[model samples]
Target: MATTTGTEAPELTGLPLLGSLFDLKNDSLGTFLRARRDHGDVVRISAGPPGIRTTVYGVFSAAGAQQVLAGESANFRKDNAFYQEVRESFGNGLLTSQDEDYLRQRRLVQPLFTRRRVDGYAAAVAAETTTLIEEWRDAGAGTVDVLQAMTRLSLRAVARILFGTDVDAAVEIVEDNFPDVGAYVLRRGYSPLNVPRDWPTPGNRRAATVHRALYEVCDRIIAERRSSGGAPGDGQDLLTLLVEAESAEDGSFDATELREQVLVFLLAGHETTATSLGFALHLLALHPEERKRAHEEVDRVLAGRTPGAGDLDALPYVTRVLKEAMRLFPAAPVIGRRAVEATVVGGVAIPAGADVIVAPWVTHRHPDYWEDAERFDPDRFTPEAEAARPRYAWFPFGGGPRACIGQHFSMLESVIALAMILQRHDLEAVDTVVPVAPAITLQAAGPARCRLTPRRP
Candidate 1:
C-alpha cells in the first residue's frame, strides 16, 4: 500500500454525525458533493456508531473507481454494510453475493442476458410501451405522475419478458413491496433485528411483510414455470432460461436460488430502469428545447411507429437524453466496497476494513471533468463528445466484473418506451421542484406531476 507523505490524516470539517446521518436520510449525492468541495477528493468521514471512514472520490476521474472496482483482488472485497442489507431481501443473488458464489451465479445468469437474448425482448418492450401510451393519450391534458407510470410500464415489461405472461395480478403486490424493500436495503439507521413485523413504526413491518410476499410471488412463478415445462416452446423469457441453465460444477440454480434470481431481476432490473426513465422524462419536460429535439428524433426514426430493437441505434438523441439523465441521477448512485487488505487509492493509503464509496451521481457531474457540470446537456453523450471521456468516468451501469448484467436490456427498454411515449404524446412538467430521494434507487419524492397532451398530426 502506498503511504501518503503528508503529515496528518485529512479530516472533513463538519458536524460529522449530523451531516452523515442527514445524507443517509436525505440526498447523499448533494451531501457528498458539498463535502468533496470542502474537504478535497479524499477525506475521511466519521459516521455511524462504529465510526466508519468513507473515501468519496470525484466521478469525473475514473482512477479511484477503477482501483476499487477492477483492480487486483488483494485490495477490495464486496463486503459492505449495504450488501448485508441487500442480502436480507435478495439473499445470495448476484447483486449481494461475493467471491465464488457470486461468480457462479453471474456466469449462469449472464448467458440469459446476452445481447442476442435481450434484443429478442424488444418487440415486447414496444408493445408494452404502446399500451401505456394509449392510456396516457386517453387522459389528455390531465396531471399525471410520470414516475408512477414509468414504474408500472417497466415493471410490466419485466413481468412479460421474464415470465412470458401478463401477470397483471402481481403488479400491485410488487409495487407495494418496492418502497419497503428499498427503505430496508438503502437506509442504514433502520434495524431488521429489532423491528417486529407488527410494529407500528413507519417502514419496519411494511418492509418485512412486503419482502415475504415478494419471495412468495417469485416462488410461485418458478413453480408454475417449471411444472408447465418452461413456458411452452421457443420462449426466450428469463424464467425459461433460468429453469434450463446449467453450471459446470453445481448444475442449474435450485428452487431457492431461482427464486432469489427472479427477485433480483424483478427488483433491480425494473425499478432502476423505471427511475432512470422517469427522471429522463422529467428532465425533458423541464427543458422544452431538448424535448423538442427528442420529439423530432422520435418522429424521424420511429415515424409514428412504435420503436423496436432495430430502431435503438437510430435514436441517438433519445439515447443521449437517457444517458444524461442517468448521469445526473444514476439509478444505483453510490456503490460501496470494503478494503480486504491495505491498499493505495490516488496516492492515499487506505487501511484494511475501510469503507469505500463510489458515487456515479457525484462523478458524472464533477466540474473538473465536465463542462457546466450542473446543467442538463444531452449533447455531452453524443458519439464525438463521448469518445473524449475517460472509460470509467460515466458508468451508470457501473464497470468491471461485478457490473450490472442487465444493462443492455435496461437501456433497450428505456429507449423503446421513451420513443413510443414520445410518438403519441407531449409531456410538460408541472412548475414544481421535485426532490430526488434514494431508496435502493433514486426516485421522485412526491409524484412527478406532468401534463400529457396528444401529439398533433
Candidate 2:
C-alpha cells in the first residue's frame, strides 16, 4: 500500500454495499452538488461492492479545480477506467490520448483550431442556423424541443464542415449511432467488473453493431476522399485540413487514424456546442429580462443582417448569455483522471493511483465564489466579475494542457447560432423546467420545449 501524506478527505456516507454507485449513476449532477455542499471541497466517494469497490476523490472547489486541472495537472493523468473505455471505444484521439501520443496529436491538431482558423467556419455555422430558423418558421407556432433541434443543427454543421461533399455519407451514421455508443461507454466505464466484451451480451452486441456502422461510414468517406485526389470545392473543410496536416518528423494520419480523429471531432465538436446552445436558449426562454437584453444586443449588432465571425466581439451581452449558460450546464460536467502520485489538493491528501474527478458543475456553483449561484445572471460573466473569480471557476471546456482544442470553434459556433436565433424569433419556455442528466455530456433528460414566435414583420 502507498504511504499517504497531508489531511485526508472525508468519506461520503452511502448505502451498505453499493455506496454512492446508484446516486452517481442516476443523478450525478445533483450528487456532486450535494457532496460539495455537505462535505466541503474535497470528498472521498466509494462505489460498488466488496473487493470490486472503487474510490474516487471528488474535487469540487474552484481552487481545487485549478489545482487538479492546471496547477498539479502533471501529477494527475488521464489513466482512469472511464478514459480507458473512451479510448477503446473512440480510439486514441485528442480527448483520450495520453503522454507521447497526446503530445504528438496536440501538436498536429493545434494549428487547425487557432482563433483565425476557427473563425473561418462561422459562415458554415450561420448557414446551418439559418436552415434551422427557416424550419422553425415553416413549422408555424408549434413548440420545438430545443435540445433535439440544437443537436441536429450542431451535428449537421460539424458534419458539413468536416466532410464537405461527403457530409451526406457521415451525418446519419454519426448522429444516429453516437447516443448508443455513449450509453455503452458509460455503462461499461462505471462498472467495476464487466463480462468480457467478446461474450456477446445484449449490450455488447448492440455496441458492436453501432461501432461497426460508425467506423464503416467514416472509413468509406476517407477512402473516397483519398481516391478522389482532391478535396470538395475550395478545400477549406476540416477533413481536408486533417488529410493535409503533416509534420516532417510526425508525418500525416493514416486511414484508421484519420477515422479516429474524425470521430473525436464529431463527438466533441457538435455535442458540446449543442449542449451549450440548447441550455442557453432554454435559460433565455425562462428568463425574459435576460432574453430581452440578448435580443436588444443581437438586433443592435446584427442590424437585420446575417452575422459573421467579425461580429463576435460586437455582441458582448449575447456572449455573456452563452457564458452563463455554460457555467450552469457545462457539457462535460464531470472530468475523470487518476492521481499519478500522492498529491495534496485544497489541503486534502490524494493517494497515488486514486481515481479523481473534477466537476465543473459543482465548482461553477460554489457558494463561496458565486452569489445567488442558481440564478441565471449573465452579468456574472462581465469582465470585472470574471477577473474577480478563480481561474477554473468556469471551465465548460476542461482546463490545463488538455483543455478543449475546440474552444474557439465551440464559442464561435455557439455565439453565431445563438445570436441568429435571437434575431429571428422570440422564445417562450413551453417546458418550465428542463431536467438534465449528466452522461458523457450533460443531457436534457426531458424536453427543453419552447415556443418560437417569429420576430420578422
Candidate 3:
C-alpha cells in the first residue's frame, strides 16, 4: 500500500496494540468528537502494536464522506468485519451482501417498499399504533417504560403490516435478541478482540440461539403461507413478495436466503422506528414548548381524529420533529465501507480491504454545516432549509445506492407513530439524561421512562 496525494492523516496516539480501540469501544461519540477536535478531518484510527496495525481511516469531513459513500461507492463494499459479524446471523441478507448478490437482493425486495406497496400497508400501521395506545391506556399512565412500549408497538406494526403475520413468538425472538447481537457486532467493530461465533461465548451463544429461532420462524411463516395457498408473488405482504420475487438472470431466493432477508427486514424495519419514536417522545417531554406546539399542530390538522395516510403530508412539523430527532441520535451511527479496490478518500489513499467510516453522527452536527449544532430545532429540515445543505450532510438512513431500502417506509411509519402518540397522550420524562448506548443502532443506556397522560378521549 502506497500513499500518493493529500497530506498523511495524523495517527491517533493511544495504548499499545489496543490503540484507540478501548476509547472507541467505550465512548464512540466522545472519541469521534475528540478526534475531530484534536486531529483534522481525516485521521488514522489505529496502528496497533506491530502485528495488528490496520489501515483504518475515520472520515469526518463531508467531502471525505461523499468520496466513500457516493463517489467511489463501487470501489468500496459492505463486506467488512462489522458486517461480517452481522453475516453470521443474517447470512447473505441485503444489509451484508456485496456485488452481484447484493444487487440481486436489492432488485427483488425493493418493489415491496415502493410508494404504492407501502401505501397499502398504512391501515395495518394505524391499527397497530391504535392497539398500542389502547394497551397504554389500560396500564393507567404512571411511569411507563417508553422504549418498551415503543418497541412492542413497532414490532407489532412491522410484523402485521410488512411481514403480514400476527405478532407472535418469532417477533418476540427478534425483539429479544436483535439488539443483543447488534451490540456485540458493533462492540467488535471498535474493540481489539475479534471473538469467533463458534467460541461458545455467552454473547455468541445467545446470538446463535436467537438467530436460529428467528430463522425457524421465517420458515414457519413461509410454510404456513404456502399451505394456505398463499404462494410467493401473492403480492400481499413483503415476505410473500420476497418469497416470489426474481430477476431475469437471478432465480428465486432459496430457503436460506428467504430466512436471512426476513430477519434483516424485521430488525431494520422496526428497531430504528422504535428507537426514533422513543427519543422523539423523550425530547418532547423535556421541552414543553415543543410538545405544546406538536399538540397544537395535531389539533389543527387531525382535529381529534386519528392520523391517516392522507394526513402524512398534512403534519409537516411531526415529520420535521422526526428528522431533527434522527439528526440528534441517528439509528445507524457509523456507516462503514471497505475498499474492495484501492481508492482515495478526499485524496488520502486507502488501500484495498481497509475500513473507511462515514458517520452521520459527526457530519450532522458539524458546527460549520449546522447552525447552533447542539440545539433541537425541527425547522432545520423544512424543505427550504434542507435543500440548502449538501445532500450527504444529514443522512440518517444513509446515502448512495446501498442506503437502507426501507427508508421511505421508515419515514412514513415514524410520522404515523409520532402523530398517533401525540394525539393520544402527553408524555413526561420519568428520567432525564440517559447515557448513550452505541450498538448496531443507538439507544439509551437504560429504558427511557415516561409518564403518559391521555390527551384524547
Among these predictions, the greatest TM-score belongs to: 2
**Per-candidate TM vs. native?**
0.91, 0.98, 0.93
C-alpha lDDT of candidate 1 relative to the true structure: 0.77
Index of the highest-lDDT prediction: 2
Q: Write the per-residue lDDT of candidate 3 for residues 92-131, one digit (tens) a residue.
A: 7988888888888888887778987887777788888888
Q: Which residue pairs in candidate 2 collide?
A: none
**What global local distance difference test value does model 2 have?**
0.88
Model 1, runs deviating above 4 Å:
1-9, 16-19, 23-26, 48-60, 188-206, 232-234
Ranking by lDDT: 2, 3, 1
lDDT of all predictions, in order shown? 0.77, 0.88, 0.78
What's the CA RMSD for each of the models?
Answer: 2.9, 1.7, 2.5
Clashes of each: 1, 0, 1
The TM-score of candidate 2 is 0.98
* lDDT score at residue 116, model 2, on the 0-100 scale: 86
Worst 10 residues of 1 by lDDT: 51-60
